[model samples]
Target chain A: MMTYDALSFLLKAVIRFGLYMLLCISIYMLSASLRKKSPVLIVPTFLSVLISGSMFVLYDARGQKSGLDHRAAVRWLCEKPILFTILLFAAAAVLLTYVTFREAHLRRTVPDRSSIKESIDHLPTGLCFYAENGRVMLVNHRMNQLCHIILGRDLQNAALVWDDLCGGSIQPDIMRLSTDSQPRFRLSDGTVWSFSRTQLPDMFQITAVDITQLHNLAQELEQKNIALEELYQRLKVYETDVEVLTRTRERLETKIGIHSELGQTLLATRSYLLDNNENKTIPVEAWKRSIALLRQNIVENAEQFTLQTLIQTATAFGISVEVTGQMPEQKDVEKLFLEAATEALTNAVRHADAKKLHISLTETADTYRICFQNDGKMPETQVTEGGGLGSLRRKAETAGGSMQIDCHPEYSLTISMPKGGTENI
Target chain B: MTRVLIVEDAPMDRQLLELYVKQSGQYELVPSVESAAFAEFCCRTTRVDLILMDVCTSLYANGIDAAEKIKQNFPQIKIIIITGQPECSFIERARKAGVDSFWYKTETAESILHVMERTMAGETVYPESTPPLQFGYITSDELTARELEVLREVVAGESDAAIAEKLYMSLRTVKGHIQSMRDKTGFRNRTELAVRARDCGLIIVDKETE
Candidate 1:
């Protein structure tokens, strides 16, 4: 009898230890489910903890009322069919919690197909992959939006859209398509999108990149190039003008030299002529050299002076040239008239000793006439045309002009030239 | 006696100018040099009352340029710019440089000694007009100013279109001017006209020799 009682105590202690272990396992599963936020594991773990705790509490209370120990109460509860059923339920709850926890862990670690699809749909650049049969394999949100805006429909066949874009058959008001080999589209919002396609193993990929800033920069560069070219042309013209100005200045210098030489020669001659002493302050050889130099200068530069220059020269030589009319505007006709005036001025100064000369210019519809008269002594004899006058007459006649000498009537010389006289020359 | 400095490249011309200065009895001869480049240095080192500067000198030094620099530093001294070349724009450049006088070596009627005396006596002597240069059958003064501009480009061997673009004239206007020049000068063609203009020293296109 004492041996039976000891075996009963030992059995009670083993069952009590097993019940405590089951209760601890259920509480641990409940805390783990709450931390993981796994609803599937939470319900089973909560129920398992409740069932084990209530069985232990009911047996301990009944044992204390019957004046039995805790180990004895656990042994008595283990013998009941309800305790076995609760144990089976606890085992099933634990299996269910473990299975639920493993599934939650896999869901947190690995990405699924739907999440990958969602990620691709939100990319910035438009991307589309289409098979040879025109079936769209994958397309991003940007690509779909672009297709809707361009084609007025949802993206269905990327190949057909690419073909349409390449054919340049899209609505031009909505998007401006470039005509170059590479496809580029300019939208109504002033956004430039550069589109390109690449061939994959069994499909084609199309990408649209935003290149508005680059496009604008390129256009600005082109305009600046044109402006630079214009500036270069203007600079070239300025260089040419400088060259011309330099040449003109050189010619002016030459004219100044001639004037200085002539003035000096005249002064020297006048001084030599005035010195009447036996021992002349200026020698005759000096006079001869000055005269020879003057003659040579006159021969070389006889026709070099312009009308203004001739008038200025006459003024310098103490002869005033008074004009009554404007000179001819035609270059050739004016040249002939100047030649006549030159000859007339020389004659008036050398022979007639003129103080003032008068020039009258008159123009008609078909002809221009100029008359030269001086305030000097009238020719006592009939005027004879010398080398100067003869050469003037020939030049006048060559240009279809006529020269007349009227010495009897105040020694006036008139030259008449037909308009367009340069043609004849 | 006024101290005069002679700056001429040609040995004969320099000797003649030196002789004239020595014989004047009124001016002292400073040591002469071949280039105007040393004029400013001579002025700095010694007493200089006058400078007879030639347009072109040895070592490619331009007299007008050097004279301009010297006048800027020493405005009290008198300078007479002289040149034998007819195509250089030295007279105007000399006047702009504030030189006292200008003398054309080949075309001057008065002696160099007289020009020096006048310059020393506070006179700024310059020629009144250039000697007329003959271009083909006509003188340079016979052509209009516009025609001369076109002729310069022609002498430089520029094409008619290029000349028109540079002068800002229409091609047809350039052609008309060339034709008018040819008619006035009685040249058979443009080549003959350009060659004659270049040969006669009417318009020099090459700056290398200037």
Candidate 2:
């Protein structure tokens, strides 16, 4: 009976000890779960396990029964139930370390969503975001700045409704579309916009971009092309004028050809007569008459050529020639003077609408001055349109001269040409 | 009157030179020899006072080559180099060959007469616009007349035949002169000689074409 009672008590103690260990293990697991933000209370957990072990040892030693006080069996137990909790916890900690290492490595290599958003915010163009319910979700800094310029207020997409956020009603058709719909809009300021939509299950993502500068640049380029085509037409006209002049020159050259031919023929006849010496009187009289006729013909031809040349030059362009000061004797001086004067006149007639034109020419021994003026408003000076006049000015400078424009409500162009032209031919 | 030996390969240019020389009245004509071999014979026996050498004497060969050979045998022989080229390299080569004077055919008649008078006075006369001394063409004056001739040939981008025709001489004579010039100036080819001459300012290569 004594041994039986001892065995039963020992068994009860064993049960109690097992229940205590289970409770202790449950508490530790709970604490570990709660303490996820910090490291698990390792020191306290180890202390609890130690205390539990000491209590189990004391209780088992005191309550010596067959089940609970089985010292011979429990003393060398490498597989204790309470110790299993520690082993499980150690395995979990190792798994957590490996997971954390891999996550840290990925974070280092790949840019995160927030980091990409930050860069997009720094962009120069406007950018906006809309949510699943078509509400304003998030917008970058660039989009925020543009909102002031466009809507005249700070935009906070607290409510993603276009009418509420934009201070005006959204396009009804565009508002009704799903978040995944990409739509485009052109604003009153000539700004063109493109909105890209992305579907995120419950939420819609819309990125609105402004393409106004690109549209304006395209329009400017189209205008430039039109101007270039007009310029090409003008060049064709100039080519025709050159061809006409060349033909006229050829026609004039034909008449001069006969004079030289006649002179040569008369000389040949004279040589024949001189060799024979038998027919002298007729040959001498013919030679003298031919000589006198040649001189008369030469003088008349020169007078005719000069008269024709003057008429052609005066009537060539829309300009009426007025006698100015004495021009230079240099062969190319007239060419230079006419070119400079023509450019000034063309500008006034074509652009300024000036009907009255006055040109004054004066010359010193070493200098030539020309003043061409019109009571016309100066055209708005554009560098692109100013290239022709600029080239003329450069030509004058090359001839050791100067050019200036005096612009009042009226226009006056003054050009100066030096005597012995520019040194840098 | 100084008895000048006329050495030229072309009939027309030779005649033109004779006319000019006769008009000057400072020089008397001797037998005109056209080849280096004949020039050597004239040099050996004739009482020649001056040698009016056309660089184109070899008929498309270098007159400088023959002049150099003649100079070797008789150092005191007064050599007058006449050419159509205006190059410093040629002037330098002629100076090295110990030529007495140089003249260009395209100069005004008065300049030609002046060069003659100066040369007869036993003064070393060279063109005012001689090339600079870089590839060492100038012994004293910047350029000699002969160097200018070679430079002009090179600048014209002419073959020996073209140069002979332009200067009224033979192709062989021009070639010989160019070869001899190359040997003296250490130039690789006629082109190099021309470029170096222009760079050295022997002739206004840019001005000649214009």
Count of steric clashes across candidates, in order:
6, 34
> Would you list the C-alpha lDDT of every candidate in the order shown?
0.72, 0.56
Name the TM-score of candidate 2.
0.27
Return the top candidate by TM-score.
1
Question: Would candidate 1 be rated incorrect, acceptable, medium or high by CAPRI criteria?
Answer: incorrect
For model 1, state the Cα shift of residue B177 in Å. 44
Which runs in model 1 stand beyond 4 Å of their true positions? A1-116, A175-177, A271-425, B1-210
Q: Estimate each model's TM-score.
A: 0.35, 0.27
Native contacts retained by candidate 2: 0.00
* Model 1 chain A worst lDDT window (10 residues): A296-305
Against the true structure, whose lDDT is highest? Answer: 1
DockQ score, prediction 1: 0.03
Model 2 bad stretches (over 4 Å): A1-93, A105-125, A129-134, A154-227, A262-425, B1-210
List the lowest-lDDT window of 10 residues for candidate 2 chain A. A299-308
